[model samples]
Target: MEQLTFSSAQEILGFLDSALGRDLLLVPVWMRNLAYRLACLQEPDNTALLRRAASDLQFVGPDWNDTAHQLLRSAEALEAARRDGGLGH
Candidate 1:
């Protein structure tokens, strides 16, 4: 199956929110990272950081037929997030 591209965190959030709103048990990567970071500060364990990194490190951008296009979109998000200081580990 082909993957889809998302432009912004807002786009990702919107897609996931819509896709998962019908399912209450769904946990988005962003929310999970927020929780993981909070947990790490309280507990400060290796496991917490590992969990957070594993969840937050991956990119979920659009999936174009051209892998380069897909990767570029993902890179754009990462770069934007990095510049805006939106990316947190």
Candidate 2:
């Protein structure tokens, strides 16, 4: 994940667009959710990407399963902050 720092929202979106499985599922659900979570943290569209989080994929997680759940919580907090007017677009 560290090697995949995205340059822009489009980069992440491009990856996601390519990964849209036949059943509409992304293979690595954690990656997909992480991207969306990062996007939601800053993008006006919520699902749009930004530089803050995606610029460092290292922050995604230290491990896979349980760590992903923790990252999701942090990402969710960012979203909540945005909703509460603590973060700006």
Off by over 4 Å in 1: 1-25, 48-52, 59-89
Full-model lDDT, candidate 2: 0.52
CA lDDT of 54 in candidate 1? 42
- Cα lDDT tens digits for candidate 1, 56-82: 434323331243343345555666776
**lDDT, candidate 2, 42-80, per-residue tens:** 353442233333433334454444544544556567677
TM-scores, each model vs. reference: 0.28, 0.39
83 Cα displacement, candidate 1 (Å): 37
In candidate 2, position 17 carries an lDDT of: 67
Candidate RMSDs in order: 13.8, 7.8
